[model samples]
Target: MKISIITVCYNSDATLEKTILSVGGQTYKNIEHIIVDGLSSDNTVKIIQKHQDKIAHWISEPDKGLYDAMNKGIEMATGDIVGILNSDDTFFSKAVLSEIALFHTKNTIDASVGNIIQHKADGKVVRAYSSKYWKPEKLKIGFMPPHPSIFFRRTLFNTLGFYELGFIIGADYELITRFFLKANISWKYSGITTTAMLVGGLSSSGSSSYQLITTEIQKALTMNGLYFSPFKIKMRFAWKIIGFLKK
Candidate 1:
């Protein structure tokens, strides 16, 4: 099965090359690497040009935001399965895509979620986030599998629609909730470490982002007709702390 992996970036020159190399090194051969750049002023486009041979489709232009760029990538994707990898992130191993392909080929599911490890600029591991404990019911508590580790069949997007452009931080939350709870899409845990993410991204930055996401999560849950409570959402942080401790 072909897998289309999308990488979105703006001024991501320092890290984009590694992300490209990770995808290029994948053991799975039938892969389509799509790059969506927000008209980066830096050397991000140059890096993309450097690895142009590895990419199947790419575009450099101004966009609304992250989700908008992702929507563009999704529109260009023609593979059987679609996945997103941030420009600052890389696959855990060359076998990562292979694992995803095998998992999908074996299991008749519409989507899959794996695991991710978050790290700092110095490469210090923060926590190992797993999808093993995730269930559709957990959306009420604002918990979700690592976004970078999730992959969906292209048909899911066609059936459910792309990421909602209305959200700033909760577009992914809204999309996941729509797929799992609202639309009742089939998904399974892949039991593999798919991506390694850099810390300090929008959702992982600090208190301000946390507060904003908390508010947006409420908005997302409400829009989906799911129950929402600020108290329940805050408890997700406690669960995160426990996961870090266990890690």
Candidate 2:
């Protein structure tokens, strides 16, 4: 199956080249690389244009925000499978897409996901978040596959729709909740490393981290057709603390 990998960027000249080269160097030949730039003031568009020959489709224009650019890329994607690789992240290896293709072909999976290595700016390993074996109920407690490590059938969008633009920070989590909890799509865990995300991302860098997690939990519950219970939310926070302590 052909895979469409979309990278969204804005003023990411410093690290965008690495992301582009990583995808261009992939062993998988049946992949399309689409870059959506947000009219960057820096040399981001120039950098993307420099490799335009290898890029399947690219556009540099003003967008509402990150998710808006992502939605634009989704509209331009023409593949059986779709994935996203942010400007600050890279595939784990040259064979990453090849491995994903093989796993999906053998298992007939609608979605494939694996682990993610969170790295500091200096490239030091900060932590590894292993997606728990997929379970609908576990999601209530803030369990989700790393967004960048997920590759799923493109048709899912035709049915479930794109990321909710209303959510600024927790849209990806809400999208996953809708897919796994509401639609009940069959997803497989690859048990392999998929992507390395640079630290200081949206959720980890700012004082908004706390608000993001809280909003994520609320959105997850709402999307799953569940009502939020103050007690349950407190318990979820408590469970997170326990997990952090164990680590």
Candidate 3:
């Protein structure tokens, strides 16, 4: 099956090239790469043009934010399966796409979820997140499949609709929980380390980022018809701490 890999960025010149190369170097040739830039002032556009042949479709213009640009990529995609690999992230290896394709053929998966390695500046993994532990009930406690590592059937978006534009930073947390619990979608974990994300991005940087994300996770859970006490969110935090220790 053809897969559409979308990369959304804004002034991401430093890491965008590697992200492009990761997709272009994939072993699977049927994949399409769609890039959506938010009117970057830097040389990001020039870099994209430099590798224009590898890109199937791209746009550089004004947009809302990360999630908004992602939504635009979703709208432009024309493949059987859709996956997002942010400008700051890359596929773990050239075989990543081939593995995802195999997961779809061998399993009844509407969405293929994988793992992500969030690394520090020196390339040491800070936390390794795998979808093997994710469950529908975990949504209430703030667990989600790593956003960049999951691939959805393009038709899933047609049925579930786009990301909520109202949320600027934390909409993805909501989208993940909504897909698993409220919509009752079919999904499975490939257990493959699909993407490697660097440290100090929107959700990974700063001291208060975790608090802000947890708040948004609670917000998404509430909006998706699953409300839990403050204790439930705390339990989620506890789980994450255990995961961090194990890693």
Candidate 4:
């Protein structure tokens, strides 16, 4: 099966090349790398041009935000399975996509989810997130699989819906809630380490980032008609601490 990897960026010059090379090095060959740049002022566009041969499709233009750029890439995707790879992230191994393809081919599922390592820009490990504990019911308590580690069938976007542009930090959470909880899409955990995610992305920075995401998560749950409590949302921090302790 062909897989389309969408990478959305803004001023990502320093790390974009590593992201590009990761896709190029994937053992899975039937892959298309699409880039949506938000009119970066840095050398991000120049880096894209330098490795144009490795990129299948790319555009540099003003966008609403991260989710908007992702929507553009999803609309441009032509593969059967689609995934988002942030500019600061890279595949955990050359065989990451290969493993995803193998697992999906063997199972009848809408999405294939995996694990991820959250690390520093210098490559020091912060924590590893696994999809093993995730369930649709956990949405109420703000549990979600690592976004970068999920490879979804492209049809989910058409059948269910796209990311809610209304959200600033919780579109991913909202989308997952919409799909897994409301729509009840079938999914499986592949137990593969899919991506090495950089810390300090939209949802992973600091206490302020946590507050923003918690608020957004509650908003997402409410929008989906799911039961949520501010107290339960705070409880997710305990789970996060457990995740860190696991490392």
lDDT of every predicted structure (CA atoms): 0.92, 0.84, 0.86, 0.92
Off by over 4 Å in 3: 242-247
Question: What C-alpha lDDT, on a 0 to 100 scale, does residue 193 get in candidate 3?
Answer: 91
Distance (Å) between predicted and true CA of 142, model 4? 1.0
State TM-scores per candidate: 0.96, 0.93, 0.94, 0.96
The superposed Cα distance between candidate 4 and the true structure at residue 28, in angstroms, equals 1.0
Off by over 4 Å in 4: 239-247
What are the per-residue Cα lDDT tens digits for candidate 4 across 119-209? 9978999988889877888888888888999999999899888999999889999999999999999999899999999888777779998
Better of 3 and 4 by TM-score: 4
Cα error of candidate 4 at position 45, Å: 0.9
Q: Return the candidate ranking by lDDT, descending.
A: 1, 4, 3, 2
For candidate 3, the per-residue lDDT at 191 reads 88
Candidate 3: tens digits of C-alpha lDDT, residues 105-204:
8887788788999987577888887888778787777677888888988888888888888775688878877777898888887888999989777886
- Please list the residue runs of candidate 2 whose C-alpha ends up more than 4 Å from where it truly belongs after superposition: 228-237, 244-247
Local error of candidate 1 at residue 192 (angstroms)? 0.9
- Report clash pairs, candidate 3: none
lDDT of 4: 0.92
Q: What tens-digit string does per-residue lDDT give for candidate 1 at 146-231?
A: 89999999989887999999998889999999999999999999998999998888887789998989888888889889876779
Worst 10 residues of 2 by lDDT: 227-236
1 versus 3: better lDDT goes to: 1
TM-score of 1: 0.96
